[model samples]
Target: MQVEYQAPLQRLNTFGIAARARCLVRVRSEDDVRALLRQPGWDWQHTFILGGGSNIVLAGDVQRTVLKVEIPGRRLLREDERGWLVEAGAGERWHDFVVWTLQQGWPGLENLALIPGTVGAAPVQNIGAYGVELQDRFHSLDAIDLETGETFTLHHEHCAFGYRDSVFKHDRPGARGMGLRGRALITRVRFWLPRRWRPELSYQDLQRKVAETGIQQPSPWQVLEWVCAIRRAKLPDPAVLGNAGSFFKNPTVTAEQCADIIGRDPRVVHYPMPDGSVKLAAGWLIDACGWRGKTVGRAGVYEKQALVLVNRGGPQDPCSGGEVMTLARLIQTSVYERFGIRLEPEPVCVG
Candidate 1:
């Protein structure tokens, strides 16, 4: 474990919010985490866990100790007639891992290409893209209990995955009567890629790719390329214009609410869920509210994709987390007032 005092965090987060951690500890392995926990007067309860820093908003200087997970490894754990079970350390970059799986001949994760953040953070957010959620490919995960420093494993059912949510995101018990939020530090994740794979082309972008390429039966690699291209075309690169991709979750509404919104604005982009609900396109809503390409203080909505909020200012005058949240709140309020649906922020806010 390596520890630093007053660590600069501007470069750590994709949003480019200037902030500092009172103490930042780089935990490279499970042993490192145990060593840190054994330190005298160490307060696990107050420590903030940081992954790839791509899915967070630093609202202010973090006063608590920051545990920057850096554990690393990836390997094939099992393979059978059913499929391949692959495991990856928490610190591995998510997009890299997805690409690696594809390179190794796994097919299920191709639809989620180009997503940001680390493997450990995927289950926490139940990260999804195109047409597949992490839960769809998740096998199991190993995590250290922050409170006891003991390791445990959880299968798919224990994760209680929901739309951009999981046990890791809640402190209170959910419908499943269990929540692991702030209590567990994920160390490794396993994915099961079935041998019997089919293209996930439910999303319009993938369908368009099919239309453009005239390839009805695209391979996993081809699908990955299409997803990456689509994402690059829509979302700005974090290195160029700092942003936490897809600032808001696509809000789901009841069928009645959908009908009401449709009555008001027929062009509203929506998709019917299997559960009889409707998922509204958050970007479309924001764009309709006239927020696309708009700036407030140092934060601005990305001109190309309204779902992304970018830091318009450079490093020296980057957008403060306050400015970002202010703009986000404004957008949320306008969206709710217009559509009678609340827009929920996707990133976790820390300080």
Candidate 2:
């Protein structure tokens, strides 16, 4: 374990936001995490757990002890005639895990290729792309209770996942049903992947890509490559620039509401949800509101992707202090005014 006081968080988050944590600790194992949690001097109220920092925005300075999880390991825990169950530590990079599965000829997670985040956070958000979601493969996870310093296993049902949300995101007040409001810290996750090949080509983008490529049944590697290519072209690279991909979640509304919006604007595109709801493209709504490529002070929406908010320049670079909440408020207000649907931010915000 490594501990530091008044540590800079600019390099820790994908946005490169300039912020400072009063105390920061890096834990490499479950035992290290439990030891820190058991310390009486450590302020549990002012402690926060962080993974890859890919889906967060640091507003200003955080006066908390930000625990950066670094536990690293992967293993095949179990296997059956149908699939294999694999376990990964919380600190593992999500993309690396996907690549590892692909190399092993496992066939699930190909559509989620190139997503930027840690494995631990995947279950929290039920991270999805193309036509698949983390929940489809998630088996269980191990989390440590911040208040008790005790670990417990959370099964798929206990997670109560709902479209980019789970027990880890909303278990606390104001978490919007994303279970991990502020109480639990994930340490490991388990996923089950099929032993045989089973491809999903439901998302319009993926289907279009397949049609354009003239491949009726694309291999897992080919599908992953296509998804990666599309993401690379659409979303800005956070390493080169500063950004957390897709600042907002696509708003899901009733089919009636979707019809109303479409009647008002024929160009509105919507995807049918499982429960008789329609998922609207938040990017489309923002673009219709003329927010695409729009800039306010140093914060601006990415020109190529309306859903992404970029720092333009590095944090503390003058061109880097755009208030994410302000931009998000604008988007929410505009979408609500135009379509009566509120846009919710997907990234975790800290101050």
- How well is each residue in 22-81 modelled by candidate 1, as lDDT tens digits? 999998899998998898997777999999899889999999999999889999999999
Off by over 4 Å in 1: 172-177
What's each prediction's TM-score? Answer: 0.98, 0.95
Tens-digit lDDT track of model 2 for 1-351: 789999988888988888888888998898988789768786566877888988888877788889898889888898889998999999999999999987876779898999998998898889999989999989999988877787888889889887898877765555334356667788899998977767788888788887898998999999999899999989998888788899899998888888999899989979997789899999989999999998776778999989898876654572333476687788889888988888898998887
Q: List the residue pairs that clash in candidate 1.
A: 62-351
